[model samples]
Target: VGAALAAAPGADEAYGGFVYIMWGEKANCLSQVAHRNLETLLSAAPNARYRFFLYGPAQAAGYRIADGLSKVQFQRYAKRGYDVHMRLVNARWGPYAPATGVRDAWADQTNVGEDWPGEDRPGEAWWYAHRSRFPYEDKKHSKLKSVQPHPRDAFFNAVVHMYLTGGVHTDLTVAFSGLEKLTTGAEAQYAMYGDGCERRDAAYDDIITEFDGWDVSLPMALYFPDAGHPALKCVLDKYDQAVQNLSGLDAMERYCLTPQAPNGFPFYHEEEPHEGDYEAPPPAGMAQLRPGHGACARYLLETCKAQTELQDPAAPALKAMTVEWMGCDAGFHWDQWRFPYAASKPFRELAAPEGFDAAGVTGVWTGAALHGKRWEEPPEEHFISKEIYRAHPATRWDHPALKAGLLARQWQRENAIADVEDADRVFAEDPDFPKCAAALPACTSFFHDFSELKDMQYYREDAPKSPRNAAAARCSPTLIIPGAEKGASTFLYSLLAEHPQMISPLKGAGFKETGAYLAGFDRPGQLWDKTSHFPLIRENEPFLTGDATVINMVDKGAAKRVVRDNPNPKVIFSLRNPTDRLWSAYRFTFNVYYKTHLPDLSYANIVNDSVDGFGQCMQRQLSGAAAAAAGAAGEDAGDAEIE
Candidate 1:
């Protein structure tokens, strides 16, 4: 036996090494067997090392030692230098306790207000801390009869049965003996164990002597206990029958539920066949050859065929083959007769030429009058009456030519023009104007107000410049005004465009081309670059990112000069009301594009969806904004501010 134990793998290690043994409650019989095996092994290899780590129902076996037996057999072995160390390892009954705390923590963070009870639960903290931890157990153990296990002890008994048999290993079992005592107490006259302790002692003696140092790990069939413990044996038999029944049922279900082709017959009951099949009677308006079996009248048959053709030409064509094969003298042959097909016709075609003449038809014309009759007459009363125009000569300048002359006179008064004659001389001397004049109609006025044109030149001479470019060129530089959406920034851009040294996209091609050249992308092509090139540094502002290289503009001198050279260099960050902005965001997210291009989400869904769902989407937007801003600032600031 010692030689066999030495040959066993994992047996030659140090004495008292940890050994974890686990078995369920229903496996109580294994406890004695395991103990017997351990004793055998220790006897064979007295110096072998091991510690017993008992878990599940196996732990209960350690508690089962009789008081007398512990002092005698068990304690004697311990004192006899047998190396056996036993310990209990805890088993989880349910999910971890920290998981429940995590759920409560989330609930606390999402609290809203008084309108929602689940969110604003001021009482929940105490309740969760004290009571919510074990709701199922509390309900089960409650004293009130109405609350007791829902339907008395039967429910709890079933729950226990499920816990025992449903793949859960626990250290407790309600055996037949225990249940009999619970149900009938001391009243029922049934022995707790069949054949009593004497029979059990005899059976144990026989089994122990024949154990023969057999390896417990070897596969061996388990047998039901003999009649000495009929109650335990009966329970084992019942469990075996249940397992066999389940396997048989599974096989039967697989066989019975296999799909079969549907029966060809329709679902309804079949009609009984007649001994001699009866023929259907001829339809109405037919001439009877035999009173009930008659040939359809020629007109009726023809009319039906024609109606069928009108409904579906193919149906008549298919019916034609059958009709011709029958060879009945019924004059209903296809194409033999024509049916009057009714359709709407134009009524005017039937009318005489003289009737159309009497209807007074006329051809389309572009002339001001038809048949030499005037359509529009000169106004008898003008919007500016002659007396009013004469009374206020300045107001008569509403006429283009008169307005130009008046503007010239005003310019002369302001000393912006040398004289009215000088204004006329400039207009006449302008090479561009004469080229434009040739294209005008001979009768139309060409001379117009030049005052606006003159004022434009004056403002153009005062524009700002970019300090970086000015320093590079050793001269005052031009400021660049970027375009933005409807906001103070846009207004500032427009205002800055009026300066002579300030180059803006709003200006002519020269300035626009220059800015585009410096940026290395076309003016319109770099629309997306606006975010990075002109980032919004303020909260609630839209951060732009047009392209990659815009960060180079953030240097100290460049940043200051970009701001200082322009008429209004300070960046104006415009923010609308929060509600309005939220609404706009909802619209843009759900509706701005064509139906197919738009997202499937509705505005209400966006506003009323879960906070986590909305938070996730906003988190993405915030991240994108942070990236854009970081790119512009040439720094790695994350989405902290946006979040």
Candidate 2:
């Protein structure tokens, strides 16, 4: 399958590429789940590229990269010699399909053959090879082309996005990590497809009964080794067919035995006006589509068949894994712990798929598991219900095995267990056993469970009152004075410090400047020690600390750093008459500091030589200001000199 997908020998370049898609403004509660899941994945695959395909405004969705992953986590990863990089892409631009405002090609073509052209039939191999155009016509199904809409329409854009920007397209809820081997596909197909449902075990017969009638065959997560895979195109084609109700056409004409196969003939066909002459159907595998509903599954099967000849070398043969959370499979409804479906099942049951190598199951795409509650889901969809616990008294959160699994999962997350090897150990080991189980009785929801498992000893160790961290917590500047150098910033800082409510950094032999922000603390190993700069204040004191770094105003990064680090810092910028400030600066630098070097030239001589240059600079500054004002008022400042 790897050879069939056309992957180069020993090049696992695509293994680290991951794709995450969100269509519209997702709620914060739901977005947090995605954030947590992404962070979890990064813990395991620290160097992987997490590409977010956001269809709508990311800010509106509260999906900022910094907001999702904490600064401390980034620092931790960076310290480990790994850069956790996430690439956010605007999914609306370029060759990508729009989520809205496209012609509803599926609207009027409810009856398959009536509107579909004979050449557009999906079964015909010619269309796959030649592909003149997408099957749908541009003509409006209704008078208004955009009138009718489907829930799956925007999701279809997700399919298009996966094709355009290939990688592993994952649902936000799915978490688990470490699937380098299967992903690189050193032994098997480049593409992999798996079920969203848990692996079927006879032991789970009673517990999994809630979803007995629900169709769980459709894969929640999809993997394609490369972008523009022909199989994905086939998936898109089938999706178009599904939207138009044309996907069932081949099955519709199966009994009729049409000589032309599914060559877009009408569903009902007769040889000679009721004289029943039997014709052979298409071959067995081609006769019945594998997924029945899932376009990807069907098309991948088709693409594999088409690749029997060497002409299409890129045709993907899918490696179908058993329906289990083999690490990479999504835990579909796992977080609906209150629901009957999840409450009865233990996490360990899903953690280790029976008979499989513990290491082989690398990642698990927990499909909408965290956020797929009724309220979060579409109105038409119902994933899990909170009332299930109320309805089923037998299914309780404190069930020993279920509680144990939940506790283990929590421990894995709390400890930042990056490797599956360590994660699996939680099932057998009870690092926080007594404490974790003691808190289980109080657990009301999935998020609240295993609260005690979190080692708060770290928090205790760095208590704000502790000598080392006291000033760090208290002295983080509430005020910053990034000065206009040579501006009377020092005098202003002195005056502010004199106020009973205000405090400046402990004045020493040096200037009242920390110079911390000037030297950027953006990257790892760059430390900003507030303690070294400011004196620790008493617990009862009502005082605000400040860093009056004079050069900070001119430092390009200082102001930005100040804003980023502080919550509501009051910035004081001291301004002075430009000419006067320049002269003061000149006197300070040339006469005071570098006076010995220029022994031959007196201050008067230096001033006399620099007057003309200073005058020109001042004139240019004034002229540029005038020009800017004039431009704002729609007037031209002719021959204005810009500084």
Candidate 3:
């Protein structure tokens, strides 16, 4: 805490300050410590702006306390000089994903006092009995007290229920921790991620659900499902999209074929295409073509009908077509475009006089822009690359055209090479990431699921587990993560275990803490070897391995034995305020020991008297043999605080 204060202010221009916290034993306790740490730091440090994102009851505690105390007291925190720009309460606890019928009692946030003033218990209680009938539940859960249409009206109601309403709205900076929930496999892929019409538009939706988290470093990662920054906007365009129409293409990319694979062509048209007119016997050109993708696109182009011709564009005939999102083709170049079949023009007059069977059979050499009064001439130069013309068996090419064709082909090869470089970079940096990216409930499409599977395979092939790690376990003494009681050893353990580079007791040994030093294993090496308990190697890199047992610092003999066995071993120690640690230990121990092991001890007596010899060697106090003699003679030599 002192160190961070001593250091000059850090910088994140977007969101000013970080609200750091550690979840503890009791949800209440965890929030308590986290709140204290956050409040202490913000009060001391000076910063340009602060964006406070709080979670659970601790956040509401302020609002609850303020409402319980007085409105003026609550306003005081916001009145401070610093810019507390945003206060978003992500008020979720218990399972991140729950069944449709289920409801969390704590999550049912309401302030009945606001409606039935001074009634305190009775009037509000009466309102609560019939509140479900009125629209009061709507304002109770909505930010700014407004209703937004939602899909699955029941789910919309569920979202409304998660709102935090206990606190009085502070300043403009205050925001509701809106509900946006979607686990990986819980719902249909498109339902939770499509354009605005899908109601799964993450860009517009609040509350995102991710179980294992993702490798955000991947290019265009956020644009995909389950991996994106909170600030990222999803669902660029809104329409009742026919998602199932492209299922086959989606499957191909997801499973055996990768999205980036050259063989699996993307749906969107490229910047340029080879041109060949259907004049004479037949024009021939070797160029890849990706025409209208879905049924709607094909129908519109085939019918030569304008956007107005379709009374309802989402008709079955048009819904299955593939097309671009939206664009402007004012320059006569095909570059200006729009998609979803509904948006693009499909008139025969816009293309050719003999539209359907024209050059290349149903090709549109020209088209009208959405706003333009008249049709524009085909921008032949833009669409027809010299490379396409050259590819034809019979061609009278100009020197300039031939040179340009060759240059374009060379550029393509260079781009392909650059793509390889990027793939390699991703592999080298996060090669083994896929092994753990297995989302709970599992992703549906092979393209999305197999994306990580392929990466995992590549990592395993490139970096096999080391045999030496098995050997290291036989002789190497375990690294220790000792604790100052209540210093978040469990929280730290879980975080470290998530890292590929670190191995904890759960990974190496069977249990989280072996307790071998205190237990006095006959042959610790043999037992460890027999169990094959070792930190497994990953990616040809050694892991930082250790076990956590908070008692080690006070266990003098345990430390001595570890030094004797392994001359050099790392030790991690975490500390907290003595009084705070005692309080936390009280909470933990009182629950476990009060009725069972320490029936004789009161909470206060335990906290005050037990602090002295809790982690000390009582024998050392009397300086060895003389004390040993006193102990042997039938005297009460051990410290009363010790036992």
Off by over 4 Å in 1: 1-503, 506-568, 582-599, 605-643
Error of 2 at 457 (Å): 34
> Residue 583 of candidate 3: its Cα lDDT?
72
Q: How close is candidate 2 to the true structure, as a TM-score?
A: 0.34
Off by over 4 Å in 2: 1-18, 21-26, 30-36, 43-48, 57-151, 186-219, 240-314, 321-323, 326-357, 365-643
- The runs of at least 3 residues in candidate 3 whose Cα sits more than 4 Å from the true structure, single-residue gaps closed, are 1-479, 507-511, 522-526, 529-531, 538-540, 560-567, 592-600, 608-643
> Cα deviation in Å at residue 372, candidate 3?
74
Specify the poorest-scoring 10-residue window by lDDT in model 2.
387-396
lDDT of 1 at 107: 16
Q: All models: lDDT?
A: 0.24, 0.39, 0.27
lDDT comparing candidate 1 with the true structure: 0.24
State the weakest 10-residue window (summed lDDT) of model 1: 363-372
The per-prediction CA RMSD against the true structure, in angstroms, equals 46.0, 22.3, 25.1
How does model 3 score by TM-score?
Answer: 0.24
- What would the per-residue lDDT of candidate 2 be over residues 316-375, giving only the tens digit for each residue? 554554323434322333323223244333332333334533234444433342232211
